[model samples]
Target chain A: METRVDGRLVRGDQTRRAVLGKAVEIASVDGLEGLSIGRLAKELEISKSGLFAHFGSKEELQLATVRAARRIYVTAVVEPALATAPGFSRVWALSECWLDYSQRRVFPGGCFFAKASHEYGARRGPVRDYLAEVNREWVQLVEQTIGEAISLGELEADPAQLAFELNAYYDSANLASLLHDDDGAIYAQARHSIRARLESAATAGTALPWRSGRSR
Target chain B: METRVDGRLVRGDQTRRAVLGKAVEIASVDGLEGLSIGRLAKELEISKSGLFAHFGSKEELQLATVRAARRIYVTAVVEPALATAPGFSRVWALSECWLDYSQRRVFPGGCFFAKASHEYGARRGPVRDYLAEVNREWVQLVEQTIGEAISLGELEADPAQLAFELNAYYDSANLASLLHDDDGAIYAQARHSIRARLESAATAGTALPWRSGRSR
Candidate 1:
């Protein structure tokens, strides 16, 4: 699946990559609708016609930017958690990775989806539709992660409800951190909330992943 | 406090009110930064410089829009909740009003603060600072509301934590409803979550307000 692409575009996937890299960061802070090719070209010190050749329209640029952000999001947030064992530990790792991603300013504007989703969540258009789709996929991933824990008998709760709560904590902390100019304590508060919620939901005899090596 | 303003500028104040009314709706969806004097004047069928004279600058326009939004927020969300007796009932009322506000489309873009706060949350500037201040005021209001519950012996959770969780549910439901296009079911889910959280945190023998009219 990785190798499937047009060979003609390969030599200068570099231009597309650079354009998208800047696009994602700007979109993360300003929004897809705010991305102007003229502004981007000015920032990149490139020809407007050259950039125009790649993305025929502003909408295309926004769409491509969203795709680029998804790739970055997967690498920063999903893969690390996937590397952990599936179940409670994986869920825990997923939460930590997400907090770290936002706390570390992976996108200069905090979580790309958090900013973009809120930006596009209200309007009706292709941009908004793509963001909504991405959000659905992300929520499904969280629910599936929780489902793994529930199926393993380590946790017992409604997957959708737990997913919603945990996602809320993740987003709330992100906004709080951003509001406070990168205050790290908000993430700790989220971690505390996540830990408490997990502890309450864990089965009576299930080993706690967070409390490992604390004394069995 | 209401009558302390300049009586000589009442007619000018009316024009300002009219501009801000439309401005809040536009800013709710497009964003505060997206609010331009020319577009606003064109939409209102007035001269750009006339509107410019009222606001003086783009930043001032954004600030006025935020203030206007805060007024609408208070009326739609806070006033109804405050009307109810303070404590768990009021807390529950606040939740209900917020869900109703979002689910009913009180603003064209759903909750204005949710959209605008995320829009400016990352950047450093006066707009961001004012939005942060508004967020602080809001969170403080939630905490103070929860404090009433705790002091009354109706609930016993940490006020800040409880506030964070409830506010999370409210804002989460708002964003979800927006993404889902005015889906009332999401608001119901939020109500369920809020009810359960409050029920869990309530002191023993505290009446569940949500169940007051329903038969056991």
Candidate 2:
């Protein structure tokens, strides 16, 4: 009985991972509400009940999908920036990583949070609450990075205000890139805006984090 | 039969308006995709076929919903702003109107364009194309308003650049307001940022657009 139980648990975990992997992709484009269980099962070639057993309910499945997307988001946007040491360099690194994440199609649709945030921005319940929490966490991470730079005397700016502005540019570029598919130049323009804003706030005696001649 | 024909036509137009009005509210919250005809008909207490007859397909329904939302958007955000003369005041007015539109929940959710833009941002179809056109029209309107200020020698800034920054603050505040419901102060903060940016760009000789000592 123990051997049989172990085998079943392994199979369940495998199915759960597979379901979530596909769920993130679908949600990235069509949104969480759009990622119906029937569609997920059909696409993954699994029994609807099999998928249902993994999450037990549609709400649970949505939550699991969000968790999956969060993992992917961290890997794509946060981890790379974290790999760089904390300070202005990490802050700048995060912006580059984010722009690249959206441009390179990390989820084959663009930034997961941008899509999810818009999808659940109006609605209430667990999904919206989760997304709102994720947003706070992300903003805090950005503010903390900016704070490191400020404490190092490399820049003189309010961390939260600058974080809000930089995040604005990043999201604006993401939406603009999607709106104008033919224009790959919006990303460069966003990068330009970010660089200029940071440079304007950099301390006079501090070294620039980026290459001096880089055109943003 | 002629009397009956007129009655039928009148009934059809009434239903069309009803559907579209509901469509905009639903789309604003759940997105254009989430505004399903079946759900709308059920909610509106009309037969699905009767609702479907007004729009031949879901795509047509979506297109109509977008058009309906656009009209409401103009009424809520642009009309009040445009009531002011086309100069520095108008620019500030536009920002105020936009913030009010989102804060007051014109569609009982938030800015319809912000929600729909993110919804169709990655998707391709007539719906997405139309949204893109509306966005271009909107950004152009902002740019034109700024241009008017520049022409009047009230502002000395690039219309496109100023438009982008102003638009960014508008959206950032909208999203922040939604995510942080308890923090009503975000709107005032957004206004502060907008005023500051505008002041920085305003020509030295121009009258300040906001009230004196309003720069908090």
Candidate 3:
């Protein structure tokens, strides 16, 4: 039996994807508040009505853009690191992938979550709540990764504390790179900080992932 | 004749001070882009023409607001730390004062520079340039403080590297506190990271400032 797909529905999904792709990029540089259906329609050559159909309101569009960005983030940062061997290597890989993601301009404006989170951090709204939830999830993921290293006796430290420090390095590097327009030294500094911090946390007998051949 | 201040000049200066006081608070929360002369004039119960006289353009207003915030930051975070004895105690005091500044909501948000820096980081122009300059100034100050500790044989670490890590912790904690609305634990976590990092760098004979009777 041949399965028939509806072309209109497929087009709708494609349009939504395209809109969100553009939305995330704009929002990364200009903030979510800068997103407008009119601008998107003009830039993308789509009807404003089409965008309205996809997103009932500006907040809805912003929320959808964030979700889209999260998906992109997982693919760019999370999955690559997860593919590595569990334990210290995975943790190191996560940091490398994150730095690469930011350095590579994965969203054309550095880390999407960092920009949006800062923009909405002080505001109380659905967007802020959603970003906070995403942040909590990311922090937990980093903590869990460190917990794996701890379980394997490869690291010795509080998972949450190490996670906090590592995440801070990632964000600080990202912002500095963007602001100072000096991609080279800022990332090198962050890499130095991360490698040194991880070295401190590594157990006495554990092989240092960064010093190993697998290091970035 | 005693130095008599001009009455009209004093009134104009007072108005400028009042406007910027509100501007920094609003910019800290809503971002500099959220600031408008009309909105400020309405909120401050002043004429739009008056704000126009003070700030000929939006960029001028933003620059003034940033300058104002820096003055407040110096008083809140830098001055108190400078009052402490040099070496490890001064470095520790800087961290404590910075955490307190953020936790106390000096700007009714978190760190004013953190929010503003992240807001204008991606954008180019005078504001971004000024922010980058301010950030460099801050990083150098931290580095110089660490150099003092190293000179006193109280700590042993690369000034730039340690400064980057410590600054990262401060910013990460600031953002987390704002987003999570958990001031107490977030600050404790930052303090723990800072103290631990400093402990790692402290010399053998040097007393840890955080462990001393003068510790926060």
Candidate 4:
């Protein structure tokens, strides 16, 4: 027997998606705390109570926005890197994709985690806790990717330390680009740092993934 | 003739200093936008009107807070570095003092600029403009210090690029430390990166400032 669709569930899911999309955009500019049901409803031309009904409270809305941002982040940064085979190529792809994601304004305000993490980092609440969790998850992903390259004998370095330095370059470039409004040079600097670190870590006889003429 | 002493003027100045100190502290955690006259008055046990009289408005209050934070920043980071003589010593000292300032929780939240810059980065306002100015002033200072080393023939590197990389490491470590409470390893990692960069930049005949085991 065929099952019938629940129209209410389908409508709620559609509304939830729409609300979250706007939530991430607003949070990108104003911050998660600055995001409000009234403002979001006014912008979306929906009733305040309707938006509140979906989120239940401001904190819930912020949490849902964080989740939505994570999905976008994975699609923009992680999925592209995953398409490359696991090794040095994947690591370089991840860095390039991340810089491109920020430079291309995937979120229209730089990296969502960079903005939101700095926003809630020092404050205490479910929002701050959730952000901290996301940060840990991202760093772990970087470290694991480095570990894969090292295990494959393509690179030889402390995965954790290399991951930390690479990530530092990524975020530093992102903030500098936003702060200075000079995007052209910042990404080039980041790419230089990433290539230098990887070159130092690459094992003997292994091809440098970022060399000028090398094919990945 | 001596100028007439006004108790009200003295009281107002004292109150203004007190208010600004607390404002920077709160803004470090919440943000300049999160700072409100009502909240400041309630927390400081002063009348809202009295605080308003001193600042005149929220915009004025934010401006004053930024100035106050700058003063604290200079004291914590610049003064200590300036105590050392110009050259690689001063440049290294500046980096050490900066890392210590963040690690010691000088602002009780983290680096004040890191928080404030990210907060107003994507938005347009006096606050964002002020932060942008501060960032330029800071980068210029780093470049100037490096230029001193270059002039003395103690180092060989592009000042602008070196400053960018060093500043990147500083901020990356700050964010990582805040995000990972259990990770005391970030500070060490940042120091390693700094030392490596400095070593690579140091002229062959020059002495290494960090080689004396002065301990960063």
Pairs of colliding residues, candidate 3: none
Worst 10 residues of 3 chain A by lDDT: A207-216
- Could you tell me the TM-score of candidate 3? 0.96
Best by lDDT: 3
In angstroms, give how far residue A128 of model 3 lies from its true place.
Answer: 0.5
Per-residue lDDT for A39-117 in model 3, tens only? 9898999899978899899899999999999999999999999999999889999999999999999988789999899
Candidate 1 lDDT, tens digit per residue, B78-172?
Answer: 89889999988888888888888887778888889989889988788988998899899989998999999889999999888888888888888
lDDT of 1: 0.87
Candidate 3, residue A143: Cα displacement in angstroms equals: 0.7
After superposition, the stretches of candidate 3 with alpha carbons farther than 4 Å from their true spots are A212-216, B213-216
Candidates 2 and 4: which is better by lDDT? 4
Q: State the displacement of the C-alpha of residue B152, model 1, in Å, after optimal TM-score superposition.
A: 1.1
Query: Residue A155's C-alpha lDDT in candidate 1?
Result: 89
Greater-DockQ candidate between 2 and 4: 4
- Candidate 1 scores a C-alpha RMSD against the true structure in Å of 2.8
Provide backbone clash counts, one per model.
0, 0, 0, 0
Model 1 per-residue lDDT tens digits across residues A1-216: 577878778845888899999999888888777788988888989899999899888888999999999999999999999999988888889999999999988998888988888888878889889888888899999999999989998889888888888888899999998888755878888898888888889898777777766644
lDDT (CA) per prediction: 0.87, 0.87, 0.91, 0.89
Question: Once superposed on the true structure, which residue ranges of model 1 sit more than 4 Å away at CA?
Answer: A1-8, B1-8, B213-215
Candidate 4 error regions (>4 Å): A1-3, A212-216, B1-5, B213-216
lDDT of 3 at B57: 91
Cα deviation at B176, candidate 2, in Å, is 2.0
